[model samples]
Target: EAGVVQSPRYKIIEKKQPVAFWCNPISGHNTLYWYRQNLGQGPELLIRYENEEAVDDSQLPKDRFSAERLKGVDSTLKIQPAELGDSAVYLCASSQLGAGGYNEQFFGPGTRLTVL
Candidate 1:
């Protein structure tokens, strides 16, 4: 268990049909994030990387949503056709200095996707 590494923690599709999510962080923590917790609402910041250079996705919403981090270590987020409000809880946090840096982000246990 590294720190920020998401997977099939939970996922159930149906709506538009198209889902993909993956992440890996916590090695050298060069700053990485990909939040979207809508249940109780809290984690927002849809994207933010520095190692592979995503800079700051600025809320991220390019049409149907999409993300990547080729050489940034590991990162992948996509939602081609999934709708139904996109469900929620897809967190993937990692920090070592970002958005006022100081390292305090360590959250995973997410991916509870359920769109029907």
Candidate 2:
């Protein structure tokens, strides 16, 4: 059984430094997603993609954060000039439409980012 893959399990960067995280979802999953988990809070949706099209990204901060799911297989999330408030666990998830019109999401061990 294949699972989601993410890189750089942990990262420490100075404020104003650029950072990027990569993720490869399970094969055949059509929906890819990115989320931010702040300390002591549930994960918040940042962006979501459906077969290479960004279906929703209203929560993403356009000025410094960006994401892409090219060909809808692999995805990447980037933060330019990271800020202290941006420190959190960036989660990557994917899912396929199943019976009953529900999508069961599989999550990867998030990449923990710490901005000082």
Candidate 3:
């Protein structure tokens, strides 16, 4: 009954460097999501996975960003050649499918990345 977990709670890197974030969702959860939040802004969905299948990822930048959910359990998100604009808090969330299809996401402490 653990909550979502993320590593390297903070990261600082120069522009053009590659950075990656990891996430471990709660057990028995059928849905996982990755979001990015800029300062003073609400989180924006970057990607969503139903089990191992990526159901939504239109917001993720394909050129320098990639994500994967291995075996429908854990997930990773990467941003290559990072830019200053990419500085934000990356959040991972998970939710269980319950009665009436209620799926309330529980978020993890985000990885705050600062690009210089």
Candidate 4:
């Protein structure tokens, strides 16, 4: 089966510009997460959603970052006034809650952003 898909594998933009990334998760996966992976570091969770509701977004920078999974399928993450520090790989992952509480996430190729 096909896994998650993300658009614009790479993007380069000037600092302070607005940017957006899109993701389409595997079919029937109800849980989704957005993560940011910096150079030489593991991905950090930015937001999480169960169905169409955002269940966790405490790590997301509300001041400049926002995300939505309106239909619990495709999701979009946006950053306004992007800063140089925002340069990183934005990843989208999805998983299904299975028996015995097993949930293994499958990640997309990710959108690499470079803020110059």
Q: lDDT values of the candidates?
A: 0.85, 0.91, 0.92, 0.92
Instruction: Put down candidate 3 lDDT per residue, 1-116, tens digits, no spaces.
Output: 68899987999999999999999999988798999999999999999889888888999999999999999989999999899999999999998753213778999999999999
Q: Which stretches of candidate 3 lie over 4 Å from their true place?
A: 97-101
User: How would you encode candidate 1's per-residue C-alpha lDDT over 32-111 as one tens digit per residue?
Assistant: 88989898778788888888888888788889999988888788899989999989989888878666256588877878
Q: What is the TM-score of each candidate against the true structure?
A: 0.32, 0.94, 0.94, 0.95
lDDT of 1: 0.85
Model 3 TM-score, all chains together = 0.94
Off by over 4 Å in 2: 97-101
Task: Give the distance in Å from residue 91's predicted Cα in candidate 2 to where it truly belongs.
Answer: 0.3
Tens-place lDDT per residue, model 2, 1-116, is 88999988999999999999999999999888899999999999998888888888999999999998887799999999899999999999899943213778899999999999
For each candidate, how many residue pairs have backbone atoms clashing (under 3 Å)? Answer: 1, 0, 0, 0
Clashing pairs in 4: none
Q: Which residue runs of candidate 1 sit more than 4 Å off their true CA positions?
A: 1-29, 44-67, 73-76, 85-94, 97-102, 105-116
Winner of 1 and 3 under TM-score: 3
| Candidate 2 lowest-lDDT run of ten | 96-105
